[model samples]
Target: MVSVLTKIFGLTNIEIAEDIVHDVLLKALESWKLKGVPENPSAWLMAAAKNKTLDFLRHKKQEEKYARQITPLLQSEYTIGHTLNNYFSENEIKDDQLRMMFVCCHDSINEESQIALILKTLCGFSVSEIAKAFLTNDSTINKRLYRAKEKLRELEIKFEIPVPSEIEKRIDQVLKALYLLFNEGYSSTEGESFIREELAAEALRLCLILSQHTAGNIPKTLALLALMYFHGARFNARIDDEGNILLLKEQNRKLWDNEMIQEGIILLNMASTGDLVSTYHIEAAIAYEHCIAKSYNDTNWKNLLNYYQVLITLTKSPVAELNSAIVISEIDGPDAALNVIFKIELADELKNYYLLPATKGDLYFRKSDMIKAKYFYDIAETLTSSPFEKKLLRKKSNMCT
Candidate 1:
């Protein structure tokens, strides 16, 4: 709704569009409480939006302030109704959404603002929810959003997708934001719940939209979507009824969504058509290996290790190296894994990361070094804010007693 309204009002008047949408929603709430929701709630809302838009244009048409590109059409009595009807059509709504995605991810705004804008405008996340997702205060999020809106207004960014030649560059920025949003849900950094399923679902939803668009139906986009599906398939098995964190090996394989897994495989194959091999491609392939494994013990560790090696070489991420070290422990021994962990050149960069010490604790436990295991586990427990992670670390520490 915001996207379509933005298209009508122009990017410079985004706040006007947002305010109108909010008013429409508020009216819905008040009316629904008295009269009950209409049978076709979606159509009802669309109709309400259309009526509100007509009212606004009729009142403001003389000012000639909205949608500069189509201001003349909007001012004319005959063209105004038809023009709006076209913009509010189903196909136009979808196109507006895609255009809005690109507009939110424009290079003028910083990355943080881009993500916040995407969540707010595209995903319907409230400011407080976005703050919670990022472990920040509402004031900070508000400021980020304020700055982003100002930038968009100052630049007069158009609500349209880039041309084919420029689409690839802009698409990467959009994908990166979506990837972070998904990760925040898959492994929440600071929250009571270990998983923020809504966030992940929203990210997947937006990515699916991107996949359907001509400008965004590229290999990298498909690969990211595949990765999301593979991860989403495991959501049901990732935690127990009590909400304690469950390691991959401890999860019930039966609970995994085979349908989602198959969908991921199909998308991954589609993503493999192009010559480009993005980090998303490697990550999705790694995830595919896990999905196909009948059991933890049956997992093809050798394949994962190779993928991680390529991932490390391609990205040079210490986190990837740490993960590769864990795979080494599976194939070689705990000692070998420990050696790799200790020798990591960027190990200091992970000093505050709970997983670094937690992985070490696991390696020590496997070596039957109880004192060292307990020490690392205690450190890991202190580093993470998530209650689920802290509980899991404490459980590991108890085993060393």
Candidate 2:
């Protein structure tokens, strides 16, 4: 809808388009409450948005100016009350959304602006939701989106997709935005819950959309999709009925979605067949190995350790090193893993990162050093914002107390 609306009204008119869509949604809720959902709900929504757009143009006295272009656009039978699904086939929607993502995440926009635009235009996130995702105030997020849209409007940037020659350079930024979306859903750095499946589902939906677009469907794209799928398959089983996080090792394998796992394996194979052996592909490979293991004891920790070792080389990030340390703790021993984890010079990025302390707490717990373990857990308990995380840390604190 963002794509189609932006194409019609131009990026400059996105705010107006959004308001119209919101009004349509409000009408839908009121109408559906009494009338029930129509047979073709999507078509109904599209027609409503179109009608709203027309109303806006007429109200503003722009109908006469836009008549030549608008008349034919509306007359097309497919543009009428046709099945909206027909307009948004997997391939077409993929291309449109990928183009939209690249546009929103363009290098011209800073990361703050890029993410705000994605949350607003693509993911249907409210200001509060985006603010919570970033662990910032809602006013801060609202200002960011307002400033971002103002920037786009002020620059008079084209709403259309970039040409083929320019796509290669822009794809990385697009992928980065998608990755952020998934990470927010998976960990939820600040929220009541540890995970938000709505956000995760939207991220996976966008990635799958990317994989179907010819311009975006590189091997790396397939790898990212496969990675998301493999991890997502266990999303439900990752939490208990009580809303506590069930660590991956303790999750019930029987509840895992086998079909998603199969699809992930297929996509991983396809990604490998292509020339892209990106870090994501390797990570998916690691996760795939984990999922295939029948039980925690059956895990191939040695292979995962090897994968993390290489990942530390490929991405040279502190988090990767931290992850490698965790894997080595499993394979070699906490003592050895401690040597590795403590040796890394990760202060610039990780000093305030809660996971650093939480991970250290786990290692210390395993070593039966309850005093140090509680201290690290205390640090994590303070740093993390999720209520679920606090509960988990308090549980650990209780164990030591």
Candidate 3:
């Protein structure tokens, strides 16, 4: 809706388009209450929006620049040959939508504002949720959004789908935002849950859209898609029937989506044809190795460690170091893992990050240091946000005690 409206009326009228869409939503909410809900609610909403836009344009012919764009588009778009169904075809709308996304993520906007606009406009994120994701105040986020849209209006940038030459450069920004969103969803830094599948689901959907486009099969793109699918395939098994957290080893692998895994593997193979390697490329490779292991015990720990090394080399993060500690415990022993952990005393970043303590607990537990393990587990329980993760930590704490 935003895509079509923005294309027709221009970015200056985005607020007007939003108002029309919001009005239709209000009507739907009211109508659904009385008329018992329409069979094709989306189609009904689109029709209402089209009518409203036409009406609005009719009244303000002289005042609107979109008055000119709407005539030809409306004629061609609304004709019997074209139809609403053709307008809304997944590929057609999506192609325009992604071009809009690239324009939204333009370098002119600061990274914070770019992300905010993309979330609110493209991804349908609420202001409050996006504010929460960044651990910032709502007013601050709102200001950024306001400033961003104002810039777009002032610049008069046409929403466009880029040509083949520009797709890779533009898509990098889009992919970055998607990754950040997926990470927030995958393992929320602020949320109580270890993972919020909703955020991950949206990211996966956007990435799938990216994958299906002409640029989709690019090696890096395929690798990222493969990585997301592999991780997504495990969502169901990661939690128990009651939604309690389940450790990877304890998870029922049978519940993992075999189709997604196979697809991921195929994409990974495709990605290997290219020489350029990104942090995501390395991380995805590591994830692929884990997915290939038939069981936890059957995992090629040595090869897994090698991938981790590659990941750390490409992107040396504290979290990567902590992750390597776990692999060391698996391959060599707790003594080896403890040496790795003790060498790094990261400051306040891990204060609220549950995985830090959770990893510590695992190493201590393996070393027969029950006292230290219990303390770490207790800390992990406090650090964790998800109901599932907290419960899992408490379970570990009880066993440790």
lDDT of each: 0.89, 0.78, 0.76
Estimate, for each residue in 175-235, the C-alpha lDDT of model 1 and write its tens digit: 9988988888887736534336888998899899999988899999999999999999998
RMSD vs true structure, all candidates: 1.7, 3.3, 3.5
- Residue-pair clashes per prediction, in order, are 0, 0, 3
lDDT of 2 by residue, 19-76 (tens): 8778988999999999999999987887787677656655653455444434444444
lDDT of 1 at 299: 98
Which is the leading candidate under lDDT? 1
Best model number under TM-score: 1
> Which parts of model 3 have CA positions greater than 4 angstroms off?
31-41, 65-90, 110-113, 128-141, 154-157, 163-166, 189-195, 347-352, 385-387
Alpha-carbon error at 131 in model 1, in Å? 1.8
Flag clash pairs in model 2: none
Which is better, 1 or 2, measured by TM-score?
Answer: 1
For candidate 3, the per-residue lDDT at 306 reads 85
lDDT of model number 1: 0.89
